[model samples]
Target chain A: MQKADALVPVSAYVARAALGRLAAEGSVKVSETEPDWAALVIRVRDHGDTQAFAALFRHFAPRVKAFLMKSGAGAALAEECAQDVMATLWQKAHLFDPARASVATWVFTIARNRRIDTLRKARRPEPEDLPWGPEPEPDQADAFELAEDTRRLGEALAQLPEKQRALIERAYFGDLSHTEIAAETGLPLGTIKSRIRLALDRLRQSMT
Target chain B: MTIRHHLTDALLMAYSAGQLPEAFSLVAATHISLCDECRARLSAFDAVGGTLIEDCDPAAMDEDSLTATLARLTGAPARPRQVDRPARGLFPAPLRDYVGGDLAAVKWRPVGLGVRQAILPTAPGGVARLLYIPAGQAVPDHGHRGTELTLVLQGAFRDESDRFGPGDLEVADQGVEHTPVAEADADCICLAATDAPLRFNSLLPRLAQPFLRM
Candidate 1:
C-alpha cells in the first residue's frame, strides 16, 4: 500500500514535468493579452525605435528613481541616476535576453549596478555569461512564459504577510545585511523560488 | 565538475540586492561563475528584485527627463552582444578579470606552512584572497568571527566536516571551527572571503595574522 502511494506522487510529478516541457516547446498558447515587454526591447535593439524606448522609459524610469532614493540617494542624484539607467537601457538593449529574464528584471539589474557604482563606488563582479542557445531568434513561448512567471512572482510577493513582505522589500532596498536577513523573519520564498526554478529549467532546456 | 555545497539563500539574496560588501561579492561572483546551480539561484533572487522594483511607488521623473535621456541616447551606440566562448580555463571569468589573467597571473606570497595567498583589491569592510595549499598540507585551524566563504577553484580539500571539490562553496560561521587539509594527489587553490578576521587557534599563526591579514 505504501509502495502504491509513493508511486502515485512520482507518476504525478512526471506528468507535470512532461506538461511543462510541452508548454515550453510552444504547444501551449500563452494568452495574447499578456504584455510583451520583450518586443519593445527588440525594437530598440534592432531599429533604435525611440517610440519603443520612450514606452519603456515612461514605465521604468520613475520606479528606478524610487529605488535609488530608497537606497539613500538624494532626489537630484536619484533623478540623474535614473536617467543614466534608462540611457544605459537604450545602449545595452542587445544584451537583454528575453528568454532568460523579463524586461523588468533586466532593468532592475542595470539599475542595481548603477546604484552600486554611484552609491557604494564598489566593483560588482558579474558571473560569466553562459553560452546561450543555438537559436538566434529567441523562442516566443519561452519569453512569454518567463514574463508570466515574473508577473506571478510579483503577485505572490503582494500576498505574503506584511512582516515577510516588508522584510523582502527591505532586503532589496539594501537595508538588510545577510546576517540580519537570516536572523529576521522567515520569508516564504518557496513559491517564488520554485516558480523561478521552473523558468530556469525551461531556459536550460532551450539552451541545450 | 560536480559541486556538492552551495551558497546559502541569504548570501545569494544579499548579492542580488547589491547589499553585500565588495569582498564577499567577489567571492560570490567567482563561485557563481563556476557553479551553474548558484547562477540559477542568483537569477531567482534577481527576479525578486525585479518584482520589488515593479511594485515600488513611482517617484515621478522631471518632465524633461525622458527627453533628456533620449537626447543622450541619440549619439550613443548599443554594445555588441557578447559572443559565448566554448570552453573555460581553471579560473572563471570574474576571477580571471580580477587577476588580469589565468593561474599564471596571481602573485603569491607565503603565509606559513606550504600555503600562499594573494589578497584581491576590493573595498573595505571585508577581505578576499586566493589561497594555495600544497598537496597534503593543512591550513591553520581557525574559527570565524563573522562569516567565512571559501570556494574551491582547483583540486580538493577536506576539513572536519566534509570534502570540498572544485566549484563547491563552504560557508562557515562563528559557531564553526575547522582545519582544512588539501587532498594528497594535487595542490588546492581556493577563493576565500571574510567580513571579520579569522581566529587562528595556533599561536604562531595568531602572531602572523596581523601581517598576513587572514
Candidate 2:
C-alpha cells in the first residue's frame, strides 16, 4: 500500500502515507504541511497513533536492543527490555514533546526508564503507592539545532580534568552515588560534588 | 549557595547517565531545566557517555538478530498505557542540591530515633547492598563483610582516620572498623555501595535487619 506524491524524499513520502493510512484506521492523524516531522510524530503519539508508533518502533527497536545488550543484559533480558521500551514509546507517545527533547532523546529516556524499572522489579518487592514525578515541559527550539549544542557538549566533557572525568564516569557509568563514589575513590563527598559542579559550570561556559 | 546544599558532581553525573533513581532523576531534571550551568554540564557528561558507548566494542550479536527483532516488533501487540512515576516532593531542591539529587529519591524508612535506611534498587540480578545509618546521628562501630564504599553527601562525619565532608569518598576494606558520628549540629547523609552486608556488633541493629534491607 503506497501513495505516489513526492514533494520530499520517496522514503519520507512513503512513511508519511503509511502514517496517514494508519491514522485513517483510527490509529493516528497526520496534518499536511507540518514543518517539524519529529513534533508531528510526537503529536501523533499523543493522539494514540498506533501506526506512527509502529514506525517509530521500527526505527528505534534495533538500537534499543543493541543498547540493552551492550549494557550487560543477557540476550533474553535484552530482548525483553527492548520490546518493553518500544511498547512504552507507543503507550507514552503523548507524553513526548519535540521542543523539550529530540526523538532520540525521548526514545532513549523511555528505554532508560524501562531498563531501570526492569532492574527494580527484578530486585526488591514492589513498593505500594509510589509517587510519580512531574513531566518536563517542552522547549521551543528546533531538534536539529540541538545537535550542534550536543556536539559542543562532547568537547566540553572531554576537557574536564582527569580526576573529574574519572569521578564522573564512576558516578554516571558505574551508577554509584556521591557517597558510593567517595567510598570508591577515597575522596570527600563534598569534593566529588564540587568537582562535578565545577566541571558542569566549565562545560556550560565553554558551550556558551 | 551553600556548597553542602548542592548535589555532588558524581551524583549529577549519575543522573545524567540515567543511573540515578527515578525519583532523584526527576529532581535533577527539574534542577537542570532551571540551572543552565548544571544542564550544560550534564549534557557534556551525557556526551562522554555517548562516546563511551560508541567506543565500547559492540559485543557480537546473534546472526539475523536484527531481522528477528523487526519481525517481533511488527507482530507485537500495541502497548497499553501505563505511567511509571517517581516519588513526589520527596526531593525538594534543598535536599536534592545537597546530595546531587540522587539520595533525595530513596524511600527512607526510619530504623531508629532519627536513624533511617533507604535501600536503593540495584541493577538486574545485581547485589542488594543497602545504606544504613542515622538520619542525623552517628553510625555505630561496624565493619564490612565485603568491600564498602562511602561518599558523604551532606554535613560532616568523623571516623578514626579522617573527617569526611561533602563530596568526600571513603574506600574501606574489611580491615577497617570504625564508628562515624555526625557533627552535632548537622545531619549526616551518605551514599554507600557494598558487595556484602554490614556486620553490626550491636544486637539492636541486628534485630532491625529483617526490616532494613541494608
Candidate 3:
C-alpha cells in the first residue's frame, strides 16, 4: 500500500481513541477530516519526533509572532509569546484530539491566549484593576485541511450575506463581544446574536 | 425559535470575529452551539481569517530566528505537563460555554451614562474595527459621511427602521440617519466599520464629532 493508504487504518484507530478522550472531556466531537488525521499523528508521535515538531514550530511560530506583533506587541515580546505558545503545543501534544478542534483552530487559540497574556503583563495595572476577566478557553472548533478546507470555507463564508461575514470577522478576530458589536454597529443585541447563531449554523451545515 | 429573532448578518460577522461584548457574545455563542447553520457560517469566517493571513504582506523576520527557535526547542528538557487551565472569571460560565471558548482579555471602558465600551485592537489599517457599548444609553443620532458597517454584539436596540440584537449586522449608506437606543433591561454593544467620521445633527453632537471618529 502507498504510505498514505498504509496509514489509514492506524489513523482511524487513533482518531477513535482521541475522540473518546475528547468525549470524556466534554469537548466538541471531531466531524471533519484534517483534524482527525492531525489528531492521530499527535497521539502517535513520541516526544522523540523532534524534527517533525520543529517543522510544525517553524510553520506556526512565525505566524503566531506576526499575529501578536500586528496586534500591538513588540517584536521581542511577540517572539516570546510565540515561543511560549509553541512550547505549550510541545508539552500538550498528547491533548490534540480531532474530535475537539481543527489543528489551525487549536494552534490559533493558543496564539490568541498567549497574546492576551502578553497584553495583560504589559500593563502596570493589578488584577483587581482589570475590567474584563481572563481570556476564555480556545474553541475546540473543527480544523479543516489547509488547501481544500480553506477553499471550501471561503466559498461558504462568501455565500453568507456580506453583513454576516463582517460580523463574524469582528467577533472572531476583532475580539468585540455582542454588546460592543451592537454599540458599534447601531443594531440591537438580540438581532446580532440571532444573526450569528444563524450564520454559524449555516456554515456548519455547508461544511458537513 | 422565531427565525426572525435570529441574529442579523452584521451581528453574525462580528460574533465570528470575537468583537461582541461579554454579555451578548455569550448569547450568540450559545445559539450558535445549538444552531448548526450558524456554526457553518462561523467556519467560513474562519476560512476568511486564514485567507487574510495568507494575503497579508509577510513581515520580515531575522534570518536566524528560525534557527534560534529550533536550537532552543531541541535543547529544552521534556517536562510532563497538563493542558493549560481553561479560561474562567471574566465572564459567566454560561456565556463562555456558547462562545466556543475565548471571551476574555478585551479592554472595556465607560462611553456614556449606563454604557461602557471597548475597542478591539485588531486589523492594521482601521479598515475593520470593533466597539462595545453598555445598555439603555442612546448613541446620539448620527449619519455616516461614508459607507459604514455595524454589528451588534450584545443586548438589544432599536433604530428608526428596525430592532437589532446580538449577531445582527447593519450596513448604512452615507445617507442613513438614526439613533440607537438600548433595550430597557439590557446594555447594547456593537462592532462598526466606517471610512469617515459620523455627522451629527446638533450642537453637542457636533462638538462630540471631533472626539468620536465613528
Candidate 4:
C-alpha cells in the first residue's frame, strides 16, 4: 500500500487513508487515540483520522520548511522536503511511542534526519547511509528521569546569560559551525569554544 | 553500559545541532544507541532543537501544501506497530545497514599484526570504518591531523589518556597522540571515523598506511 502511495499524483493524505484501510483489512487490532497531538498521531495510525492529521500538518509543516531553509536547503527544496516529511509522519505514525519522547521531539528528530538524508543523497552515492528506519524508544523506566530533565531543560536554558544564549541559538538553530559562529559574532574562536562549553556544562548539571 | 570515555560536550552539541559531518554522525548515533545516559543527553539537546525551530522566523508555505499533504496521507502505507522488544543486538540499525547484518557478516581485512579494518562508504572529506583488533594487540602510535572519533563496540582499549570500553568514545584532535592497545582475553571492535590522515610515528606503520587507508 505504501508503494502505491508513492505513485499517485493525488493528495498524500488520501494515500494515507487508503494505507490505513489496507492495514485495517488485515487481522490486526486498532487502538484508541489519546488526547494530545502525539495521541492524534496514534489516531492517524489506527483509524486514519484525517482531522488529526490535518491539525498536525498545519502546525508542523511551516516550521519544518523554515527549519530546512535555515539548515541550508533552498526554499523550493525545503518545501519539497517538508511535504515528504509530513507524509512520512503519517505513514510511520505507528512507530510513535509517547513513553519515549513528546510529539514535538519525535517530529523534530525526523525532520533533522530527513534533512541529513536529503543533503547526503546529493553528495554521497550510498543508499544505506540513510541513518535507520525509526528510532527505538528510550527506556520507559526513565520517564520520571526524562520528565525531570525536560523540566530542568527549560529552566536551565532560560537561566543562561544572554550572551551565552545567543551563542547557543546560533549554534543550535542558525546551524553555524564553530568557525562560522566565530566569524559572525566577531569573537575569537577560543571565546566561542569556552562559552559553548560553559553553557553545556550548565545544562548537563541541571539535567543530571 | 558504564562508558568511561565519551564524545566531548562540544561534539555532542554539534551532533545534536545537525552540524557534524556524516562519518562523525555515525559515531555519535552508534554510541548513543548503546549508552542510555548519552542518549538522554542527546534527547535533551533535541528538545532544545525543537524550541529553537519553533522560534525560527516562519516561512510561508504554499497555500495547497497542507491540503496536498493531507491528500497524500490518505494513501500512506501503514507501518507495523510492533517494535523490537529488546532491540536484539549490540549494533544499532544504522550501523547494521552499513555493515550489512551483524558483527559476523563484516568483511574485515588485516591492517597490522592481529588488527583488521573495513572502510565504510562515507561522504567525501571523511572516512569511516570498522576495526577489529585481537586481544592484547596494539594499533600504531599516531597523532591526528584532524578529528578522529573511535567508539568501541566490544572489549576495551587503553591509550595515553585513559581506558575505553564498550560504548566509550575517544574524540581525538590535532593535539592528541596515542597508541591504542586492546584489552587481554577479549577482542576489541570499534566504529571509527577520521576527517584527515594520521601522523604515524615510525616508518613501518607509515609504509602500511596507504594500504590501511588511514
Best by DockQ: 1
Error of 3 at B108 (Å): 24
DockQ preference between candidates 3 and 4, better one? 4
Name the 10 consecutive residues with the lowest summed lDDT in model 2 chain A. Answer: A123-132
Q: At residue A15, what lDDT does model 4 achieve?
A: 55
lDDT of 1 by residue, A6-74 (tens): 233334444544665677898975455644668988877877766666667767899999999998899
- CA RMSD of each candidate after superposition: 13.7, 11.9, 14.2, 11.5
Q: What DockQ results do all the predictions give, each relative to the true complex? A: 0.27, 0.11, 0.11, 0.20
Write model 2 residue lDDT over A77-150, tens digit each, in one string: 87667667765564455555443344655555565556665643321121121122332333344335454444
> Candidate 2 overall Cα lDDT vs. reference?
0.49
TM-score of each: 0.83, 0.47, 0.41, 0.71
Kindly list the interface RMSD, in angstroms, of each predicted candidate in the order they appear. Answer: 11.7, 9.0, 9.9, 7.4
Backbone clashes per model, in order? 0, 31, 103, 22
Q: Pick the candidate with the highest TM-score.
A: 1
In model 2 chain B, where is the ten-residue run with the lowest total lDDT?
A: B122-131
lDDT of 4 by residue, B124-168 (tens): 446789998899999754345677889999899998878998888
Interface RMSD of 2: 9.0
